[model samples]
Target: MTSLTTTQRQIVESDLGQCITHEKLLGEGWSNTVSCINNKWVARFPHTPESTQVAVEKQFLYAFGKGSPINLPNLKQTEGNYCLYPLLDGKRLNLEEAAKLSHQEKQKACHQLGEFLSWLHTSSFTDENLSTAPYGEADFYQDLWQYVAEALPCDLRLKAEAYLDSYFTTVPDEERKPVICHGDLGLNNILWDNSNAISSIIDFTDLFLCDPAYDFNAFYSYFGQKWVNMMSETYTPHIGDHFWQRVTFNKLRKALFVVYYARHFGYESYIPGRIESIKESLSQQLI
Candidate 1:
């Protein structure tokens, strides 16, 4: 039994037919409400007011699905503005569970994640439908540097920019070139099952072709120093970019995005946490 807004019910029923029924609302998400529909599909609806960026996310899903380690729900029926996808196993991947995995399982998980990421960084994603990643390294720092050069009034943005400039001062622009990165690869976005293995991935709204450091740090940001050191040691040897250059470059760049997000679409309570993180980001300038 689908318990959706009358308009929503109409939309789903029209798309999938009345023979189908929605049952068990999985949960509401930041941008979409996900529910099990027709017993086999997951119907994701952008809440009222709609997420204009949902289309961009749909595009990212196509790319990510191509490289995912586990089975992912391909986009199925799209109605009104919402999309329907197959239901992945409804489970979450977290550190507590990651810790319990056997050594072999841990290695397998890391390998799968690394391979998924390698596909993104190495693939040439130039097509009429998808924009080619921007050219060269100067282009990488250009926006954030300009934002800082203009010296915006927002303390967080300005502070983040200042730290960015100092960090880039040492590393050459040519080394800061872009790579495809999972711009927001947090625990909540990844799905797993009781075996503590990755079942599927969700949320491509923050996907971007940018510095690979941004993706690598997700392990640190979501878990802690332990994972960070492990991943960095494994990944750094494979990277071509100046290490610190990419680190600070993407950290502050992403931080700037955070402020931009907080100012507009985010909740009031989010400001303080973002502000604190911004300050912390500024303070970590060793390069």
Candidate 2:
């Protein structure tokens, strides 16, 4: 549990039209502070006044999430600093929790996730402002390596550079047009219900246009190639020849970014796990 500041408490009270008798911290992310109010409502407050994430997420949810096959946050109120929504009932499907599921349960969850991704990728959103380039581009990776290489261990650093060199040389151009992606679809963002099914997909702050393969990176990182193959069984979009290669690249890139930024942003706890992931990716020849 986390304590709220006086201002945050006041904001929640004012928005809900009632006093907050019970409030529990849900989690904090790079951009937002989330809390559950009275076990019924979830409130998200941005970390900075300059952020447009609250507004952008509110707009996307209101405009596109109504008919979604999976449960999405139903925002109840929105202000410049914060937003509130009905708490979707579930626990975050983190790696440990997912490992507890039976094989049958995993299959069901994957199928549901596949169907949801199919719906999301195929559905059209014609907002050019939301369009952004894929994260796996050569220039972006080069810049990222430059920024974080000094902090990485010597062996890991060499491996990362070698991987990037190989990736850029063999990587294909953008053959598939961009589509709206959840941006960060890691297990932390997925929810599991008591019945062992995916209850909802939450945290749309990173939503934007990018390669379809970018969406599968988190899944592959968390659950491995076999699990991702299960997900692909129901994922309807045409898989490009280079799709899996891009996914592996995105996974490594995401881990590096997390490790460096976690330290830069003073989130020390996130660094160790990400460092291990980077090491594992290199050792397993995931690139």
Candidate 3:
């Protein structure tokens, strides 16, 4: 577990206007070191001293999050490279828990997620500079390959390279419009309440502008086509001709990235499952 520095402790104390009574490390990801303070607030400190993701997340939450159907982080204070917000009341809705849901429960989860995505994708933003197209660039995959290739098994490496090559050459639809996306909408970021509902969506660090289909990729990867269909029923937007194609690509890409992340971040337990997911994904023809 990553420990909080003395400076960070001081910052938290300064923000709360008192000495800490309780503190717990929630998670430490590539972007931020997260902790629960006093069981009332969540503190996120950027790993990179130069990172501006904390401030950007704060701006986005305050700007577009107010009208959201789902709860978003309410930032209490931001200073230096850290930000503090009230801790949301719920546990992470992991894959095991999600699998246990009944049909009705699954449908409800789909509805809430679908509605939230609809609202997010439809939200207007004038500053095009605020949006980034990291995934759309071939260089991004090239860089990712450099980090992930050596970690993959020999059999998987060949397939992974081929996929990256194909993705690099493939041209995206020019007519597709970009939307504000929850760039990292995996299971870990979704908070589920005791009432069996999605309580909140957290971690907006990878938030960016991209194809709306990118948002559905995680759901497809997690729950398969049936769950995606259920969610699509409630989503207001018309599905584009190439929507599922992009979703398929995103799913495969993310699965590979998970392998790399697991190896790099000391989460080796994730590697086997992700490798299986990669094999399953590679076996299918790209849509």
Candidate 4:
């Protein structure tokens, strides 16, 4: 049996004629509560106001799905605050499962993912449905710094502040060319098949237009610089000379957010690892 709020229960019951079975919670993300119904359909309910981006995400899927190099979810149903789709095939990979793959397999996956990102970043698709936040790279960094200031230890917070100051000076707004970002393209959002190949990418709630290097922060977080460089080599001319610097800055931003919100966000278990990753990312910075 699966647990659902009255709203979710009513929606599912109404859609499936009260014969729905095998309901189980899949997971909760920053903005949505997701669950499976009868092992066939996945239902997502907005956990926060931000989750309402589902409607726009659906439009992106429709606009880009046909020519997408990698698999993406197909919109199946939408009702009020709930959105439904067929459960995509394959399983999400954890770090341990990903490490089990041979180097060649990992490289192959990067190549494939690189190709997918290139297609995504270079897409000409535009819409009034997407976010129109009037922020550049510096503004975004400032936002992250403000959030992390209270969360991180004094020493780490100071270091992060210095990093941001230096980054803003060295990499100015003129160098930034905004591209569509998969906002939260981390390990959890990626699905892998039996052969360790990418099956599909999910979760578009954080989709926004920002520096293309912002997307590579996930590579540093999940697979480190080696794979990041490998993927970059295949991603083409889009990655710039200061790409690593950009990636490092973005990684710091993410680490700070997790550190600040861990307990409050119900992810206390993830704090230690996230802090360590922040340290490592800071150490690797070329600045």
Candidate 5:
């Protein structure tokens, strides 16, 4: 049997909202059903059972946005299975959108995002008022390596594991800077308003900490080398030079992550693409 399409998901969302008339099917994301709710609100709900994730996206939105200068999505309310995200005037903000903006606007947006991430990483996450997990720097990478070793093809997977081991072996644990990290940070997940500014960050499922470089991995993937120099200039003026190594590590680690997900999820189509990305990382970072 085929899985539910966007139309079926719209029905489910309409049922949840109890709307009289269902409107357009806005877009279908990697794991969620997205549709117009009451022609005003956009309702995003998980389509697959494995989709509900560890990171508390809604919780992060509430906590992270409290005093943030950059805007994240404002949470409206939650029904049983769906979350209501307020409508923004932004369009699809993949790297393609950056080209439409002038260099100055791009510069402003990059700086704003850099500052936002800097604050997120510097801010501590404790269990005082919120229910959370304890994370250590080495623990995060160890877990990542384990996941990759189990997920990728035996040959590629073993090589990647050894690569990680050698990289960390020379580095002392005490030298690692611990900070909160956005487990997943990239262009597809960011939204920009009509004015060419990032208006909302939609997904918050992959929240964790190991290195802030993990956050900037998206730069190489989506925005291309064209963005690297500009991004470095914008961030260094504030946070200092601490994230590049982590970013390089993150780039390689994430390529392994792609293989891991494909193996576990049985998404055959992803394997080829992931292998290609992994090869790219090996050529670039393994030297």
Candidate 6:
């Protein structure tokens, strides 16, 4: 466990009104340093001013507390750039553990997750201060395609360009209505119970309003097409045909986003695998 800064220590002491008896680093991600404090609370420190995750917890998370189908964090400190919450129970599901689940188990998890997402998307939780999504269909395709064009080898780039041409002409923003999105619904952020059902969905740092299909991107990336199809079958009645098209767009955008940042961050080794995945996701027809 890393030592807590004096500021962090004081923040906890001030908030909890007790000395910490135990502390340890729980995990670190792109924007926040998460630590367990006194074996009961999670202290999250944002390393960058751009990390408005603390604000997300303060502004948005509480509204989802009672009615939300899955567990959400209950904030302990609400008035600062750093946030503290009760330590949530459950293990984060890794790829190996996820793969080990039986088909019935997988379907059960997918079904439950699907139902939770359906409620999240349809919920009347609104905040005027919440940010709009960074990309619309046209912009998502165009910007990410440019990133793909510059990053990929010529052969792959050509195929990506062809897919982009089709997407730009076929799917426009007017065709799809926006809904609130979880922003970064990656596997690492999802917590699972011993029975393999989802216990909690964490990290609302990237929350915004966008196509509901964007929420399915992480599920597709980790679970594959069949799993996505299963989840979609349940959600489709709410969204209709534009749902799969948005899913394809979101998948491609995520891939290009990975490549774009990987190159920017000099993570060259990741580009090849990400590029292949990009190609595969792009090959799907805009449903």
- The lDDT leader among the candidates is 2
Over all chains combined, what TM-score does candidate 2 have? 0.85
**Model 3 CA lDDT for position 67:** 86
* lDDT scores in order: 0.59, 0.76, 0.75, 0.73, 0.60, 0.72
Q: What 10-residue stretch in candidate 5 is worst by lDDT?
A: 128-137
Return whichever of 1 and 3 wins on lDDT: 3
The backbone clash count of each candidate, in order, is 0, 0, 0, 0, 1, 0
Tens-place lDDT digits, model 1, residues 85-156: 777775775677766778766665665566566665665543332322321123435532443334334665
Error of 6 at 155 (Å): 4.1
Q: Which ten residues in a row have the lowest lDDT in candidate 1?
A: 129-138
Task: Write down the TM-score of every candidate.
Answer: 0.73, 0.85, 0.82, 0.83, 0.74, 0.84
lDDT for each residue of candidate 3 in 46-138, tens digit (9 for 90 to 100): 776665555666677877777899998887745666778888988886788899998998999899988999998888743433555432333
Comparing 2 and 6 on lDDT, the stronger one: 2
Model 6, which residues run further than 4 Å from truth?
133-143, 172-175, 259-287
The collision pairs in model 4 are: none
Clashes of 6: 0
**Higher-TM-score candidate of 1 and 6:** 6
Candidate 2 pairs with clashing backbones: none
**Tens digit per residue, CA lDDT, model 5, 140-168:** 45544565445456666667667767667
lDDT of 6 by residue, 1-287 (tens): 76578877887888899998899998876557889988899888876645454575567777666577788888774566777889899888788888888888888878767877887778676775555533232355454567666655676667766766776677766545677778788778888888888888887766777777778988877777888877765563366656676777777666676666566545778778887776565555322
- Compared with the true structure, what per-residue lDDT tens digits does model 4 show for residues 32-148? 788898889888776654444666677788778768788888766555556677899989878887877899988988888788889888878666656634222234545445654
Candidate 3: the clashing residue pairs are none
Report residue 186 deviation for candidate 2 (angstroms): 2.2
After superposition, the stretches of candidate 3 with alpha carbons farther than 4 Å from their true spots are: 126-141, 145-172, 256-280, 284-287
